[model samples]
Target: MKPDTSTIDIRAMALLIILCASWGLNQVAIKAAVADIPPVLQAGIRSMGATCLMLVWMTIKKKSLLEKDGTLLWGLICGLLFSAEFVLIYWGLEFTNASRSTIFLNTSPFVVALGAHLFIRAEYLSRIQIIGMVLAFAGILVAFHESLNLPDSGMIKGDIMLMGAAVFWGATTVVIKASPLAKVYPGKVLLYQLGVSAVILPVASIFLGEPPVQALTPLVISSLIYQTVWVAFFTYVTWFWLIRTYPVSRLAPFTFLTPLFGVLAGSWLLGETVTIYLLCALAMVGAGIYLVNRR
Candidate 1:
């Protein structure tokens, strides 16, 4: 039997960077639509739509959607965590700016690093790698220095929610890494998340009294398409493949770069300001990614 990959190679690195960029831009899309659709409902819509697309694609590919894999339990857990992450993120954005959201949301890697060290065999982090994770997070703070100081009264609550989402995000990755889901088809793994969230988010949205859709403007429509097609479906499929094919600990830290890309995408797409902090933060993030991946 082939041993699992223990490091990030060139192709995985490139794919991770692309996933980060896609995720960064996805945040802006979420923010763009939240004003028109209630946050939880919007997430529900994204998941619901992505689930449809995945269903069709898997059908075309003749992939089994309901195979009796031993991964059922873990898959459901991942879905719940995935649902929670989205619910927290969109709901939190209602109370916080994207800058602060990025800062808190990207803390997921620390959870992955710690969890993988304890549970996953042969995935321990050296001291330098731990520093790399911290450095990458520091880059996120620097990237959003202004947002960190924003004086919104609800900012604390929003930040706490975002932090909770990060934990769920990390825990989901660790669960997949340590469970039977790691050995399943990537599309199936993503289906677990998309499918479960598909049901849960919408039901919760109803319980929360969130409107299914408020405005349905072009921006909202485009945002939903971007999220469902690209972020939720494509990139997530790639993300699952990556975690299964490589070390989850090595892959998770690159998410630290997501908010940096979010900041830049915000500047390009939303006219948010850019500053010297981004450049310095980029350098630190680069260094951090390197240190963690060092042989």
Candidate 2:
């Protein structure tokens, strides 16, 4: 079937739903595996595996990796930002429930929308978008209000770290869109991220005193494989392709489903408690995302 030029077709919508589900399930997988492998170390290993897989895919597709693209500097920057983002995510997951972290991480869109307004003249946010951003920020506050009041709270720390990761994630998006990296092949764009993180994360894991090998249980191994293949490789590539083929404004709203799925998956798979605050925050953030992405 021919691709729709300006609208989301049934196939695209179905794929988007599937992609969101995979992403949500990924958080549960990480939570399950982190007991056997330290969070940063687990992330490092998964990135390393993903890097190799990306290389293999590139080879199969006959994609050139050594092209003298003027985007190398931007690629490296993106890699660093990408690495930092995941580092925070994996570490924060240690202290907070995966459901909570996912909610905070979904704030990246607001960050991106605001940053775009400031830097990209053509991408200014409307008044409705501004209200949406405020609502989302309020949701974050609602989610963290109690945790923040307690002294030396790990939950607060985790929430802050996840929020920082969301910022980095958004910044990475802005960089890719603004820099020459936008002109590079999407596969190579991903390769740069995975390759750089492959090196940086392992070293960071070592320095941070994370062991190279923990108890490699069946669950751990399965989680690692799922993350490497599904989350990092397939889902990410699909997202990049969607960005290329669809109106991002239309596709962006569907992202709200991800955190909802994340919360549900975490509660179901990990037996995490879903507090009222969390549900309230989810509702606000989900509504905000819709408004922010509305055209």
Candidate 3:
């Protein structure tokens, strides 16, 4: 429970698995609804809904929403980075398969691991961990190779955009670890992100000339609700807690599992392609993550 701990206990592992599973499926949820709702508009609405939920949860907990804390500047910076991440992700999903998007986006751990090493004095990667990072990243390179060679050029574009989002996400983690936001309430940290993105994304949707609402099928609405309530609001709060409670380097390895779950979810739900190459990449990434965690 202490902050900056080097090891992950059983409770953290269990919650992390659950988080990865939900996140993996989250890509599928976005894709499922993409046909009915435009991507940026969908993301905007999800952020708005999740922001409302964040407000209510904080209010019920007697947390002050308007505290004049020093975190405002860093918090807004985090929010802007968070906004950029989702904008790219939702837009990327339009061009690539959910499985591919997941594979590329989860590369944030590399970004986090390296950034933490450079910025946070308490967090440094060991030689084994560095090796683990390379192996895991090699897996990503394998999948990325397939993307570039695909006849569909749009897939390459989407994959690159998702990778860009990974940088933003990784930067967000580093900022939270290195800045004043680390001392603030986790929900409020999330609130800053959700609130800022709620306004920016909808405006983005409008500025981009995306229609407000094209179709509202039951499944699409359910997907939006699930994204808003569970993935964005609840699980992300838990993620911030984990970040505050554990070493960022130690927590980085576990994210490799997310793409596996996402690939499976995409295969089952959207019938997206899943090649043996991707499976091999998953295996290598798993081994690499294990090495990173090994003492």
Candidate 4:
């Protein structure tokens, strides 16, 4: 039987917020890591590390490591989508400013909403949800309009790549909603993606042929660890858990927070510029999210 949304509990919300916060901080972590580690290599290593940990955990828990009930095909498909999405994101980051990347990347929610509306029976967005989505999109614009407008900024390339990445992520989620894999454990879902990414990223990194690890500073190492643990392990698992427990549509709107925090942190920590437009965008996004989810 399909799970009822009305039965969602407090633990789900707590998990959601924690995951969102980690994803928010993830942009900064990626930026910091990419400064020293080659972007592809960084992605590869992080995925490999996460995969190892997840596999170990799954083993201890005695979850089916070898895909019971013909789920391996679906898992492999999801993993391919997962791998492609991050590859684009990591490479895009090298060309783009983190704050602008976050703003543009937040476009994924809209794509997901649209996809759900078109494809899924259970995931409809009400008029209020639509309004909230527009508000959040507008908020992103407000938050990054100045940076976006600046001439000679490399942001154009990065923003494009991130936008593409968002679409990829959106499509992946839609597939998840449609696939039989939804019936499987969330841990299985994550493992498929991480394990595939582990193999794909490393091979791709080799072809990209990054220079030997030149200077692995403490900052870089810390950032990589943060991405591997908090972003990869904690946040991804939390996200899968939320998908299992809550209404996907209601919770997806909250993901606007990821980019909101990303923009703020980039400005504060990395000395990225803050502009009036961004402040206005942030206000609109917060208000929109509040209105949409207030029920």
Comparing 1 with 3 on TM-score, the higher-scoring candidate is: 1
- For model 4, the superposed segments whose C-alpha errors exceed 4 Å read 1-10, 94-99, 150-159, 271-279
lDDT (C-alpha) at residue 176 in model 4: 74
User: Candidate 4: deviation at residue 156, Å?
Assistant: 5.8
The window of 10 residues in a row where model 4 has the poorest summed lDDT is 2-11
User: Could you tell me which 10 consecutive residues in candidate 3 have the lowest summed lDDT?
Assistant: 142-151
User: Which candidate achieves the best TM-score against the true structure?
Assistant: 1
TM per model? 0.92, 0.81, 0.89, 0.87
- For model 3, residues 1-295, the per-residue Cα lDDT tens digits are 5542577777888898899889889878977887788888888888899999999998999999788878998989999999999888877877897657766887899899989989998788888888988898777667556554453788889989899999999999999988878888999999999999998999888876777687888999899998999999989999998888777887877887777777778888888888887788888887887787776
Model 3 spans with C-alpha error above 4 angstroms: 1-4, 92-104, 142-145, 150-160, 271-275
Q: Per-residue lDDT tens digits of candidate 1, residues 248-290?
A: 8899888888888887898999999878999999999999999
Better of 1 and 3 by lDDT: 1
On a 0 to 100 scale, what is the lDDT of residue 26 in model 2?
83
Task: Give lDDT: candidate 4, residue 22.
Answer: 77
Model 1: CA > 4 A from native? 1-4, 94-97, 149-154
Best by lDDT: 1
